[model samples]
Target: MRLDPQKTEFDLGYLGKQSQISVYWNLSSPQLIEQSIINKEANLSPTGALLVSTGEFTGRSPNDKYIVNYQEPSDQEIDWGKVNQPFLPEKFDQLLVKVLSHLESKNIYVQDVLVGSNPQHQRRVRLLTEYAWSALFARDLLIPGIDMYADGPDFTIIQAPTFCADPQIDGTLTKTFIVIDFVKRIVLIGNTQYAGEIKKAVFTIMNRLLPGENVLPMHCSANIGMQGDTALFFGLSGTGKTTLSSDPDRFLIGDDEHGWAQDGVFNFEGGCYAKTINLKKDLEPIIWDASQSFGSVLENVTFDEDTRLLDFTDSSVTENTRAAYALDNVARRVKSGMGGHPDHIFFLSADAFGVLPPIASLSPNQAAYYFLSGYTAKLAGTERGLGCEPQATFSACFGAPFMPLNPVKYANMLREKIFDHHSSVWLVNTGWTGGPYGIGSRIKLPYTRAIISAAIKGILEEAPSEYEPFFGLKIPGIIPGVPSKMLNPVKNWESPDKYAEMAEKLKAKFRKNIDQYKGEIDSELLTLL
Candidate 1:
């Protein structure tokens, strides 16, 4: 196998010195795009974004993910259950050998990047992928310009999309597998072309490791106002974390993952991996324009074959369509990718049940309660096996699949940070209102934007608020540019009695879900449920 003459001076001996793999190290976005097209792995949109299909798997397969249980202190700390499933260390080693053997005689792409923007807490990562576009995805989503690591990467991801695991022999649930060994500081992903697994695997490692260093790793988007006030938006996929945080008025700190240090909050990524299903130029001009720019990677998005024109509204392939582009593509992004401690935090929930208020203020304990609850509808296409209808689900910390440690650990850290920084927390519902899913219309984007803008400007703090007894949330009576009637969710429904019934049902769900954390959390906080 021939190696690229421009390959960095880093050693590939750890992967196997005997393997004759052609390594293409640290290729630029344009070069990667060229390779992608040449390899028939992707096509270019009219505007130059690389368009590729993720094949059968368009979303993450949570059940297929695992963490090796052999690690000493780290393995014992992992929340060992379905989300943080345990895999045999020997099995992992066997699978890694097989995956590396599969890559032999094939071209591989390597990218050395940093996970955190702040140098003090940044994690060095070395990503190896079988596809050029996959390497580009990593480069686009991670901090680049790391020529070499002095002591090797803090974590190394080996993604072999074409290499499938044998469930019976490999100990994986399926042919697709994502196995991370914390002790080894290595991640192995097989039989999944879904690029999200690559990004999320890195996040999972950070979630597991950051708490030890006293840095709170978060699954949220952050942006700063003109006055330099930072705001955080937290939610699972399809709940508007990306859309809400990409405010035209504010400079985007990061779109997805972040780390809150004692000094400030820093982005975990150098780019935004935004959901593009039904994206419109007028509503989300920044993301829309970025999605169409050169060097961007559009995954699972449909386009006109002959014309090479992208149709953002097309969801025939999947509603989980995504665009991965560097932060430079966004004009209103923070160049440093860091922000002061967040002054306000928004917990975004697409309440398909339509019982929750559009926006509500939370006390400290209530913040912890709701943070642990992390309620949202499992939107269609966000995960595999979900139908078109939305299903209500609770993901602790809004990212249960990625969080390896216990939910209580992150909750406690968040509460401590809030107390130290005096940050205000608000619950924002970007989901349906007036009624549940099909019967009700989604809360308008402009109205939600208005609510957030008012909150950022401190308009809601002084506004008259009414007690929402069901969940004990403080609902503002009015928000600037938003209809007063829309503030209270029950009033928007046709039948108050039906609304009451639904509210009671949802309240019961919150209680049932939080029951797991009964002894773990403050008992007084449970009363808020």
Candidate 2:
């Protein structure tokens, strides 16, 4: 591999010249695999994929993430609390020095990559990591470096996973820290070894910056039909966003992270980071095939010692087992990873509470209401602290931690876009039915897929519909392959009284969440509800 010395000349003014850095620039996937093995950082699976364990942290540490309070153009614009916590600029400088100091004599792998498939909004990103596998992970997930030295980077990330922080000195709650200074276009990551951090930090950056430009960034899966119609699936982890989007028939644009711009919907990532827990080849052929590929990275997944076969059922490490692979590996995927304006947008919810209908059509206001509510169960192992059991939660726009602006901003943008594009919105519950979580069996994947197919084919559009009183969602009375009774949650429940009780509890939760966004939300949405 040819080392581009020009790309190495990044302006690391915070890093001193005395630091002896071994820089590996733009290494090919095979070269990176060799380096990882040489450095004892990764083990190759029998399938030839790179397998590595993220020690201690199997998921994202949201509490430790913070953005520097630069008090500039973005200070007031940033929604500053909890998810978007503030870090003093002084503390950031101190920590930056500490991070650079630790990496002074270490071998650092650098990948100058690109984000955003749209040419107009493409962001060149420079990633520096202490681990070769982490660098490869970034390369697998982000757009590869090609003429990146000429393109230049919009943001520079310095990641030192082994470098620990002092809470008392750093003013951080924990030893791990993910500090971002948008003002300086720099990201500092320390202590945490989870690769998901790298993926999400960049997403947070985009979420913060894109709205001001009138771009609606979404944490969803998107695909285009053969006829050029595009569809988007929005949901939290384990809600089948990745699973449903990888349909054998549709052309996948991307599995996650997309932006709805004036021209169309463009992918923000070059790859798909898919949850592999209980993944069966027959169920998810696309992702399953990709996970077994040579360049893909498997995180916290178990494999047999002798056969070296993966055990998707194993959750000893974490249930949030994942596989990261480029989009090209999928059997059917868009070449450019960009799609025309989406004609159908489905809000996916793994309704563990089992009160939501299997599939329902939503009005514009209902779409905005549910979008802001972002109602879904928290999938275990997706975050730093979570279990396999479903936990009901509301994340604004389905990506609260990543959104920098207020929830209403994204909701408003989505409403405007839906109106302008004449998009049809549907609510899909990929969670449970019969009863909540343990009481009921999880919804079958085939059934969910059939329901989704009906929506995508526009069959549900002409179907007879009935109003789901609590949520005010228009439940279709019949779908081609779906059981007529399953279309409405109330009918599936053995006891109507219990169904009503559970539905009321969920409605209360929704009301409580929406109350926080009272003035910002349209009164029409409330009336529809």
Candidate 3:
């Protein structure tokens, strides 16, 4: 098979002989999009956005993920267990050979990119994909500032979505697998075309490598205000990290992964991968407009074939429908993809229990405690097996799937950063209020926005506050443009007794979940729980 005549100097010799594959290296977005259309891999929307549907599996397959338990560094460092499952090196090699063999007769697209926005910590990543659309996705989600001809990649990701592994032979749990061999600095992905896997695999690598360099890799969104005040929003999927940080009033640094270093926070990605399900133009005009722009990659989003228009409300494909576009697509964003140490840090939780106040001021210890707990409700379609109902869950650091180290590592880093920067941390509940998920209504977007705005503007610092004894959160008595009663969850509830019961239940869940990390975290932080 012939290699693309326009190939770069990046070598593929280490991946055994690749004589059977037609390798297309470093194709531009337009070229990749055109290839995708020619190969019948994706369709062009009316707005010129590339629309692709990830068949069968629409979300990440966490159960099938693994990390090679090869010697040294990774073996001793990675907190290997359920989250970071171990895969034998031999098995990885076998799977790699099989995957490469499968790709022999097919076209493979390669992209050379960087992972971090800051040059100091930037990681050269080379992505090899079976589909042209997947290569376009990698280009859209990753920092494309690297010169492929200059140096080889620090890490390589080979994704073959069409190559299904035999669970028995390949040592995979299923046909789908995402295995990371840190020692080899290579990642393997198969059977799943949910583009997010490609994005998050790089994040997982950063999470493992950054901590040692004194950089706290985070699963959060960040923005800067007019006065140059920067704010961070940390939360799990469907908790509004992307939505809240895409504020028109502020300049966005990045929408997903970031690294908080000694100087400031720098984004890990060059783009924003935003959830598009139930997306409203009125509420999230920035993301809405970006999703409708040309060169953006829309994954699993429903559209009218004749009109070529997207229906953001439709969830038949999957609620996890997403839009991937470059950071430039956003009008209000930091061109450098970096922000100063945050003045305010918000831990957003979609508390389906509805017992948490709409907004609560968090002490240092409280912030660390909540950060480690990473309490949030698992919304439907965010992952496989989650039904329509929201289920209360604790994902340490709000990104346990991507975090390879102990939760305490990130928690301690956050505590140190918060104390070092004198940043105010707030627990903002974007979840249901008044009652539980089904019984109570979700908090209004406008009201949540008002509370966040007030906090960022430092309007609620000296506001009259009352302590919530159950969680020990200080609830603000008043917020500009929001009803005072809405700030206090107990007051919004129909039955105070019911709210107390739900609060107690959630408190128990927190204590139980945090117990696993009891010995590692500070006893003082535990007391805040």
Candidate 4:
């Protein structure tokens, strides 16, 4: 409500500008709703409707009203290269009195407040809050209007909620922001948090507000568990990242997002940001309970006091229906059980394209090749669960959207990690068998889970998984549950023409990406493809 808070500014000129996409959102704040109405320059779409408290996003949701609010070109708006400079609450030292003068009455219960940022955007406030600071009425805040430009000079104005926090209070800053001016490669977005089961797990995620680290942090699902010592799982929004990771037999480390550290991998938050859409009690019971907690923030679920129930399928929260809750929501929580160098890095390809196999083991080079060549197709509205129409897309990583590092750099890391850790990674196609994506049904979640579980267990490397020499691994047994013919795309499909055409198109796309990496990758890795 007030803009006069004296704010401490961070000079994040590390990554440069125009390289990253920045976000200024609160974990849970009414101010976000307020900004939509107040800031005309802040480019906001009613996308928050996906995060609204009302039924605007519920079933039968009308066509999107997400009109871009800010009129500035993205180039001038987001500076991916600048680091997130988080100073002491000194942020408001200059504007405090002015800001304080503006607020009529925010919370009389509040007294003191402070601010911080993560230069690398690798740290999280909520997860470490218990280990650090002391405050009253402390909550995440956002200012959409000012976010259109840089935070340092032009407008150091930060729209933070006034929290009565004590700097001298027992804890140090819960979140610390720093710059990683190292190599710009090895950065991939979305996967930073959601890729689980057997991933290059990075838990201590979400650093500074806009620290340009040449990397991107995104939201999705992930799973990884050691079988003979290895973890791996992959699923898109509806595929089953949650179902597979909830395996009772595994020593469940934190699920969802994590960060990489010199000491291995650490979970970013104490929780998981799970989708509650059409959430089935039989499948996602854990997320259901986690969504109701005080600290838990609901994205776009319809909340009704009279019913005391959340209609998760309601798009009002987000078509995603997410719940950001501590991973502790599960009884068997692993504070830091993962991050051992991956012995098997699996990249899941939910190919609505329907041209790939049910599962294909790969050599580190092949793995790297595919990882950088993220290939998949979306089923007709399966992404939004409507008849919206299917489409195809490819990225260096399953999550190219949030990657702060370069594709080659990340591929190099995967190569190095695979070799150093001797990991066995794979590219599993959970797409179609009988036909290409649109006409065929997606592989059943249960069957997909069985295959993934088997893959983690080395079952794929056992008997039936015929060895593919170039791939550096074996394709094993059909693990009783799934239809035997479905295991191989060639067998499951009645026609190979469609599969061939799709494969050719993908290969051409892969070839087009070749020149981009010709100079970055090693000769041998390049030769593998």
lDDT of 4 by residue, 482-514 (tens): 777775665566676665566666566666765
Q: What is the lDDT of residue 485 in candidate 2?
A: 83
Which pairs in model 2 have colliding backbones? Answer: none
Query: Would you list the rank order by TM-score, best first?
Result: 1, 3, 2, 4
**How much lDDT does candidate 2 score?**
0.88
TM-score for predicted model 3 compared with the true structure:
0.97
Decoy 4 TM-score against native = 0.60
Question: Which candidate number would show the highest lDDT if scored against the true structure?
Answer: 1
**What tens-digit string does per-residue lDDT give for candidate 2 at 266-327?**
99999999999999999999999998798999998998877778888999999889999988
Cα displacement (Å) at residue 470, model 3: 0.9
Candidate 2 error regions (>4 Å)? 1-11, 14-20, 148-152
Residues 1-529 of candidate 1: C-alpha lDDT, one tens digit per residue: 6333354443556654453455888898988998898899999998899999999999999999999997586478889999989999889889988988787757888889999998888889998888999999998898895576767788899999999899899999889999998877889998989999999999999998889989999999999999999999999999998999988999999999999998999999999999999899899999999878889999988888899888888888888999999999999999999999999999999999999999999988989888898999998887899988889999999999999999999999999999999999999999989999989889999999999999999999899999877777889998888989889998899999999999999999999999888777878877776
Worst 10 residues of 3 by lDDT: 2-11
Better of 2 and 3 by TM-score: 3
* Candidate 4 lDDT: 0.42
Q: Which regions of candidate 4 fall more than 4 Å away from where they truly are?
A: 1-230, 234-243, 260-262, 292-295, 303-305, 314-318, 337-339, 377-387, 466-474, 523-529
Find the 10 residues in a row with the least total lDDT in model 1: 2-11
lDDT of 3 by residue, 248-359 (tens): 8999999889999988999999889999998999999999999878889999898898988889999998889999998878888999999999999999999999989999
Better of 2 and 3 by lDDT: 3
Assess candidate 2 and give its TM-score to the true structure: 0.96
